[model samples]
Target: MDIRWITAFLDFEPAAHERATAFWSAVTGYAVSEPRGEHAEFATLIPPNGDAYLRVQRQEEGPSRIHLDLHVDDVRRHADRAISLGATELVACDYVTLRSPGGLEFCFVTHPGESAPPMTQWDGGLASAASQLCIDVPASRWDAERDFWGGVLGVPIEYAGGSYAQTPPSADRPMHLVLQRLDDDPPTVGAHLDFETNARDDEAARHQELGATVLDTGPEWTVLRDPAGLPYCICGPDCR
Candidate 1:
């Protein structure tokens, strides 16, 4: 894919729409763009500093999840290549909606941009950036899904032990795209937001105070569920 930009969309159903929007807007300190789309269900979190890469979409009904959009120069050209790499086409319009082999939904669309948003600095000196999208793939589909993503993105795939792999951060590439092979099937392929922060504990606490619930804690990250029940993580030890 000749990716020019990327955006991660957080999805929620009608009932949780307002809460999801508010929590994320507060967390990222970005102003929300007016909802667009035919159903008035799309909005962007316009970052104060750099290019915007975060958005929210309201689904009629479904569990809250995140999906990625690859903005390329030629939508059809890149999308055709994506299909050749085993991405199943789900819908097509001005953009192509497709699912990777493991099933995480994504789209190929045209948008013009280069720089990604910079790390947000808070008043207390805590800094962080919504810098990654972690896709959860089933163990059985790991090989195919991993190859599919790497093939389509045309980025070097780096491994972290046996469980995690990621497309290393590139200055002009959008967000860090990661793949996590799960032990068993998860019913569907899904993704979660990952934010890198200098102060993990404090950052997690900040989210908790703003309506997110702590889900679990790990050696390198803290898992949390926003009010919409969408699981996201706060990573630490580095702000990159």
Candidate 2:
């Protein structure tokens, strides 16, 4: 499968969509495109240049969460490939949704375009930027989850440490897919975006100004919840 593009979607409850859109736009330095879809549930964050890699979705149901979209030339072919590697189908239609063996949900969609926004540096307020999706997998499923993504994406698994493994992005795809082993089991496996920053404290403060609340902080990263209550992290300068 040719993984032509990658996008991180911010899924929010219908009631909280507007707040999520405004907060994300402020922090990422992108303008929200006009809504699309039958109920106007979908919109893209327009970067100053290049195609968008971030999108916002107003879901009628389900808790706020992040999911990845892998764009390919043949959605069925790629979906089949993903299923063969232990992904269970969730929805099958014009596009396909699959839950990985470890339980994180992702989808396969036909490539929309070829343009990818350049990796940006901290500009208006954020020191660096959101550039990677970290999938939190239970420790019991760690090895298999790593193998499944590596096989489906055709990328070598690089270890960030004993508990974290990542699939490095190619020149064409700008976002990294990371598998992180959690100490305790989560109700459901899920993913979240990570921002690499030179000034974690300053970035955290800016996020607060935009309606994000600091949930917790550690030496290397700070966990925060967006206005819609989705959790994401801001990492130290060493992150990429």
Candidate 3:
């Protein structure tokens, strides 16, 4: 099962879908496709050139969160491989949804010839380029989660710090998968999108202008909430 494509999906509530779509389009410099699906809940964020790597979906239930879509040559084979590596199957339909060892949910879908979008360049010395899907793992599940993703994706896990591990991007696959070990008493597991920027403050300000709020800030990254209340991050220059 070859991992042919990776997509970062922004799941939003129905009431907030429009706002979320508009905000993300402005931030990433992409155009949103017409809504598809039975309830018109699914849409793609299309880049001016190249294939789309981002999508938006209106959730029928639960709060907004980020999830990944792995497009593979064989969905069933990929799902089986993931399950054998400790992922629990959640659904098996047109696509297969599985929860990783660290608790982050992702899906295996048929390849649609999608490819990573090229990084956009912004003016004002605000270089907000490249996007990353970060997997938040509990400290206890960190090692297993890292190993699971590395094996499933056929990528090497590169340790950045005591708690940070990431799979470097290759020419064929441009998206990155980062595993971050949390320090919470009972660590929480989830996924979030991260934007690499040369000017964090300026880029964050731009996002604020587009209706996103800064939830928190650290030495290297700033946490933000979209109009739909989904949390994402803006990491500093070192992000890759």
Candidate 4:
């Protein structure tokens, strides 16, 4: 099973342009792209092959559109690193959750025992996994959702933690999964992306086996919803 990239969005309300830029840059160690306009919009400048980005947009209230999550090799180590870097611990459960100086929330969950490649490419270990955005669900319901995500889609829940549910990818590929309850909001539907098996016949078989109900299908993409009314879709390899 190949795991691909997962993208997330953040509503940076009660935040200023300069502060947001600096905060995200410091957190991800990536440069900030110039704003397209003056209303405080920015995109993270990532390496050409990197899988994540931080798109900061002004919000009237706060974070209505998305919550962020991440997969870490070791949650405790990175969470400590984040804290040392001036990130504050927000929620500490099975995994460690932290907020940037600008108040953006994210968490780090250790991917399980399976041996993944190291962060280097064109050589020895696989690329080290670091992301700027993740999907957050409720911590309490993570197990249920993990089962549903696995059962509905015929995919295994590869790695799990207090607030995270990960689906590992095949060797030499990327990874993606959802984070549960990084906040205190009530349970509601969310839209996300999932990768199915490569072959059309195999993907279709997995879709039916996983209980995925199709909402839209295009030559390049197929949109569907999970059992809990969440908006999730399957895409061809190029959709990344």
Q: Considering every candidate listed, which one attains the maximal lDDT? A: 1
Candidate 4 Cα outliers beyond 4 Å, as residue runs: 1-4, 14-17, 37-42, 48-52, 63-129, 132-136, 151-154, 159-164, 170-175, 178-240
Distance from true position, residue 62, model 3, in Å? 1.0
- The order of the candidates by lDDT, greatest first, is 1, 2, 3, 4
lDDT of 1 at 143: 85
The reply for model 3, stretches above 4 Å from the true place, is: 112-115, 185-188
Q: How many backbone clashes does candidate 2 have?
A: 0
TM-score for each prediction? 0.95, 0.92, 0.91, 0.39
Global CA lDDT computed for model 1 = 0.85
Lowest lDDT 10-residue stretch of candidate 4: 124-133
Model 1 lDDT per residue over 161-239, tens place:
7689987676875477788898888777789888888999999989889999998998888999988999899998452
Q: Which candidate do you rate higher for lDDT, 1 or 4?
A: 1
- lDDT by residue (45-161, candidate 3, tens digit) is 888877888899999988888889998878898899899998999999989999887777899998555555566778764666547888888777777878899878877888888
Q: Judging by TM-score against the true structure, name the best candidate.
A: 1
RMSD of each: 1.5, 2.0, 2.0, 19.8
> Measured by C-alpha RMSD in angstroms, how accurate is candidate 1?
1.5
lDDT of 4: 0.47
Error of 2 at 233 (Å): 0.6
Model 1, C-alpha of 231: deviation from truth (Å): 0.5
Cα-lDDT of candidate 3 = 0.83
Q: What is the lDDT of residue 146 in candidate 3?
A: 82
